[model samples]
Target: MPICVYWGEDDFAIEKAVALLRDRVLDPMWTSFNYTSFPPEQADAAIQGLNQVMTPTFGAGGRLVWLINNTLCQHCPDNVLAELLRTLPIIPENSFLLLTSRNKPDERLKSTKLLKQFATEFREFPLIPPWKTELLVQSVNQAALAADVKLTSKTAQLLAESVGNDTRLLYNEIEKLRLYAEGSNKPLDVATVTQLVRNTTQNSLQLAAAIRTGDTAKALGTLADLINASEPGLRIIATLIGQFRTWLWVKIMIESGERNQQAIASAADIGNPKRIYFLQQEIKFLSVEQLISCLPLLLELEISLKQGASEITILQTKVIELCQICRGS
Candidate 1:
């Protein structure tokens, strides 16, 4: 084998590996190649093909890189590939082949007769799905380690909850925290975390609620709060209009016998999953006028915001106007 190879769904590990390759350590001999993708269907082709390319000694005396993936390895013919492998001995010193996949290698890996001999020195890292409860804490800690900072467990957990449990988002949030927390040794508490992290979720939630309640002042306040926090005014108005329209559409759909809130929530692709149950109660009494009247106000806000109208004022007017309609004013 050339040097090292990887197998996992861990994007972080793959990213680190890529960084090392990009840096290209000279004295100890290091190089890297990243593949576009690798999926399960291409497994057998990958094994035989990689074996040929990743060898111990280079004929030309330099490092080799064959970053194998689903598309690249899926169609290689077996016998011809075996012929390529026959030219190189089992262990080729100067070559390194790295393979990555979202899905872990399975029984095929364990049972593959061809790969059995090479399995001894093989480094296999499988990315396991994290428990929902522990995910945030783990993500924060991992981020801290990467940033070379000491993040407290409490701080880490708090930071994790602040950002949704998406690893990619968490990665971005942690980077922000690292920069803000620089030269500050104090463990990040919720207050510090909150100040540093923008709560776009709350902004979205409040804006949606303001639109729903039709309280123009509340709507304007929410918009102002968002703008003060550096969110684009146009995006806030647009997202609110979209979400409210979806809510109204689903409300109408439920009235027409599409009453299954879970089904509605799935189709709509917004709203808290928990809110699905609450929505049934809320939507049950929604009048067609409530939806009809609010739609124009929302459209007006969108148009005005887009047209460079005073977004804050338009939002405020829209909110108050919506509340009146919703409340049968």
Candidate 2:
């Protein structure tokens, strides 16, 4: 029997499966998910740790959910997994076992194994294309549904585009929005999504959003994160410049009477039509000057960061100043 693996490039699907399993196994009053990992060489240690999980707790407590998130097969050539197979029959009902891995187990294990006979549930995760805005919305709606929160299709679309591919951020933003929507008649549209789903770190769009909102502190902080991520000043500038250029290209395409989404996506070389579709709606908000200004400062920051100073501080100041300039401050 194959170990239930939630395998997906779509972080949301993997997380959903994991969350479902975590809830099922965990006793709300006692404990939550416990995680352990094993590399190919860490078989012995992994075995010991997993076995410890099976041991009974003396004190009064709820169920403990176990997640084996690793890159190795616990069973080695010496039959580590086979031993695991044998032990499955004895796993206590108090503990739930969940495996979230991206490996393909050996054929022998799958062929002769009875692992499935033990698991309460088994399912694989699904992958979603990064540009699937509709699917992204659906995912958000599903997560919201899990929490008993209602989200409109428009609101879901806005949230998905605003949050992009970061599932954790999406979850965080939804938590915030759920609080605000308690008694308010206001729905989650682009403007509300913009206000509620603020990016905690800076990216090309984060900086742009900071500029759009005249947020100097956030814009500066974004630069700090970029630096910490080892993204060079030049690269950041190049990416922003490219984003603007893409927007400009898209703007020109729109002006040329391309009304259909497929035509606009192809014109802009957008691999994801879903992104291009919403991007068409967003192009009107940005000005050409903002893009032009960002490029020169990015170039300056590139030079300053490489040669003249504490690269972190200099880059931070440059970005804050850019945010100020864009804000007309």
Candidate 3:
């Protein structure tokens, strides 16, 4: 029950969870003496952390040794693995060892299997993909509850759309809303969210939507907004590629006479089968050929961006071409 493993792309969530765990397990008065942390850059961090956790507590409270950005689960050297094998099972009852990484642990690795066998708490904090609206809405609702802020269902949806998969932004916005609602009796409404939350409505996902609808002007404008907001060009292209690829899969499946929603969802890698209905409607007007052609252009754009091309100029040109393709011109 003293060994914990937390891994995922959701850095903010993981940090928050670690802080909570530290507070819950370590006594506040003796925190300075009881806590130790190993940064990823440190040499032999995993081995050092193992040694630290196996040591007895100093004074008043239990000990906590954190291995931040640990990669042992991904690639454990033999010596480190040996240390873990020796130290983990015999860790002191008054001490806790916590390992955190942004990468998912490879289940096939001996280190990962060992952690699975011994870790009392193993959790993943994956970031929800921007295309998944329902999950984002649920995330907003849960954050609101934790912040003691009440929001109408519509307001939660609006916040989700506004923030997308940015957990830190979502939490900050919810806290801001909570402060604004401190004296009010009613739950925050859509209008209040619109008034307070900075309109990040212009994002990569909106760019994809504009391209799908063949709105060159809208696409270009959204791209400008994103660039102005300092969104990285490669990140934008990545999102576009993922979105178009999903559309292509859905289109291909439906055209192949696949009627099972679950089957299409699975093939498309969509988490919820219910979303298959909406995706079908969204791509109903587009042909498989058009969807198929988009991948090359997206790949080309990614290449150009990585090759030191001007981001704004290249993005603008490709966005127009994509819009034209979607329009069947």
Candidate number achieving the greatest lDDT relative to the actual structure: 3
Residue 179 shift from truth in candidate 2, angstroms: 2.1
Total backbone clashes of candidate 1, pairs 3 or more residues apart or in separate chains: 16
> lDDT by residue for model 3 over 263-314, one digit each (tens)?
9999999888998998999898999999999999999999999999999999
Which 10 residues in a row give candidate 1 its minimum summed lDDT?
A: 25-34
Sequence-dependent TM-score of model 1 = 0.45
* Pairs with backbone N, CA or C atoms under 3 Å apart (clashes), candidate 2: 1-113, 30-62, 75-81, 202-222
Candidate 2, superposed: residue stretches over 4 Å from native: 1-43, 57-67, 71-75, 102-114, 147-150, 199-329
lDDT of 1 by residue, 1-329 (tens): 43334455566656666456434522233322322223445555555545545444423334434344332222335653464355234444544444444444443432223333343223444432221325446666877788766667776766654553445566777778778778987766766676777553445546666656656677667777777766666656555666566667667667778866667767756434555666556555557667777778778877888898986667666677777777673
Candidate 1 stretches with Cα past 4 Å from truth are: 1-172, 175-202, 270-275, 282-285
Q: How big is the positional error of residue 7 in model 1, measured in Å on the Cα after superposition?
A: 26
Q: Which of the two, 1 or 2, has more lDDT?
A: 2
Residue lDDT tens for model 2, 1-329: 11344444456667767676556655555552343333434556546645755766433443343445543233444454665666667766665445555554443655224444555555555544333445667778877776555677777876766665567777878888888777765555666666767643345555555654557888777767767766556555555555555665676777777777777777766666667756666656555565566667766776775686777677677767767666762
Q: Between 1 and 2, whose TM-score is larger?
A: 2
> Alpha carbon lDDT of residue 142, candidate 1?
73
User: Top TM-score: which candidate number?
Assistant: 3
